[model samples]
Target: MLDFPNWQNWIEKPSSIIKKLRQKLDQMVGVEIKLAEARSGPPTGMALNLEIRGEDFNQMSEAVEEIKQKIKNIPGLVDLTDDFDRSRPELKVIIDRDKASRLGLRARDIANTVRTAFNGKKVSVFRDGTEEYDIWVQLDQSFRSNQSDLSSLFIYTPSGEPVRLSEIARVDSGPSYGSIRHVDTVRTITISADAFRMPGPVLVMKTKQVLNKLDLPQGVTYQFTGEDENRKESQIFIGQALIIAILLILVVMVAQFNSIALPLIVISSVLMSVMGVIIGLIVHDRPFGIIMTGVGTVALAGIVVNNAIVMLDYVIKLRKKGYQRNEAMILAAAVRFRPVVLTAVTTVLGLVPIAIGMDIDFSRESIILFGAASASFWKSMALAIMYGLGVTTLLTLFLLPALYSLVEGGKERLRGLFSSKEIVY
Candidate 1:
């Protein structure tokens, strides 16, 4: 394992370093290398993990090879390989049932003899002091090195008669799988790779496009697993959580204000915050971290509403004191401006250091900027809240009061219309 200095000291980005290393490593003969970035959260095995499952091993192996060939050329995909072990050499003993029966030897007896001769059978226990070991009996390596040697071995029949192994069975040598993997009692072959400069989703999308051309055999199916699978699942879960949070916030706001319009007006700040988050990510050239950013968005739903609630609540209180709607809105803005701006500014300032990965070392009496890995992990969440609260604060102070006046004016107009039409009833 290799460890490097802080990211601040690096002359080149980690992705560029990995790419150069990959180029050099690819030139080495008969070697496979997988380079992965350390990340937080549950281990997902690999960035791109696809499982091809089927009943027939031959068909699955063929499909695995075809898929590998098709995807090996995808840009930014590295360490393309599979879990199917095809390099192991195996020897098979084919018993002739007729010959064995004529020789008074059952197939099990022949198999046991072959297994014992090669794999060794535990015959007895040897005791030395308080320790014991099982003694195994088997042919030496010199006597079982080749097919000819194996065929020249002896086997005993049920009647205690010795017979030559070649008379009843044949030994064949071939390449076989070293291990077999199963999922739900069905054989599975997994192909996995790591993403280099590109994002996992983009690499997976490109791989999917290539895999669409794959013609799988009957009963053979493929599914994506590993980090790609975990990412999709996390996206769905975050989306659901965001929706539930919004709903709960809406319910609480409605109960507090006793009017749907006020709650909806406050909820508009949440939308503004979302827009700000999107814009911030784009401006900073950062990918929208699904988990961190999503959680931050949900948290923003509760926070951004505070400014709107404060302003709107003040407007309502002023109106009860016999102030006109427009006057109340203006006064509410003037009175709440300092509180709202201060709140937002303090929060944004607090997160600036975090989003930029800045830290202060009291011992060294120096400022460290962009040198913390943990800060980098949480930077997305901080930026999300900072950008979101900043935008929503402005909207709450300016646009929110205008919306309140508009809604109140519309309400009065409706009331007048209803009151004037009462005679028609």
Candidate 2:
């Protein structure tokens, strides 16, 4: 997928259309904005990573708070989240030379000794599963005791000297640099998240506001990127493809019907399918989530169009073969019943995979979309097609009869135009 390498570049680069749209978004429903990487991980496109940093724990916490505010203020984002404690690592102590020399010690000694105390070194080595494991013995919790013990601890010098750690430098504990997690490496020191209620333009605007408001500290910078970015690219590409597909369907319908008006009537049955899908979605109380709404909408159109074509083609064939309009309509209905039933039933069966929410992740939103897209959903879809199809059917059955009757009744009126009133029965 194409990702904006630098969202900052795009955000900073002036676009009149984008600016105007943003203004309207501000005036209307507002927007949700965010600053994240296009993807996390290394450049190989094989992973994702999030690296967060803060001046101090307090500063880190403040930065996090700022992120929360940014997320909340985003226009359509809701349920902002991240993996809890995913980036959180405990304090790890590292020594400073100047401070250590002021007392009488070196950084190496403190580092080495502390390493042994916290993370022991290998005193023995063993082999297991074609791999080597180094084992060592060292002081545990009760022995190390507290920070006071670190100062009181003694270390040996290269000159066969022993000195108290406090005499050489300060002993402290603080947050560590690296973070740990299950998935792609996302190491954050101080970061926050904001999710929007909707995707597309709404999320973009909200994120814009956040980026504009951000006040960066010296040596601190950020970027705007995430799944939202991925979504935007996908939406654009799919939109074009969908337009092409619809045009193709229209062409196919026109070719089959050979009449612009009736073809239009049949093609429009797609709308009934859409209405039914929407009603099902609404009744099931599912919001238009990222995945569910997109695929479901496209699928609905095909279902409706296919159904209409079956019925219309049969009726048109009968009419072209010299049967009276009403007779043709009834005959078409009788002949098409088996095919129509088979098609509808098969389509519903095909939906079983969808009903299982294959695309919707195992998240709360997924459940909502799937539950809302309940079994009765097909019924709603059928209702819309039924309305259009029923109307077309009735017109087909009654059109020729009505026209003939009207012409016969007007025979008297026609006599005025004929000089020799010779009428043949």
Q: Judged by lDDT, which candidate is best?
A: 1
Please provide, for model 2 over 76-119, each residue's C-alpha lDDT reduced to its tens digit, 9 standing for 90 to 100: 44334433342434544545567566555676667888778766
TM-score for each candidate, following the candidate numbering: 0.93, 0.46
Q: Write the per-residue lDDT of candidate 1 for residues 263-284, one digit (tens) a residue.
A: 8888888889999999888887
Q: Model 2 Cα displacement at 24 (Å)?
A: 44
- How far does residue 300 in candidate 1 sit from its true spot (Å)? 1.3
By TM-score, the best candidate is 1
Whole-model Cα lDDT of every candidate shown, in order: 0.86, 0.52
Q: How far does residue 148 in candidate 1 sit from its true spot (Å)? A: 1.9
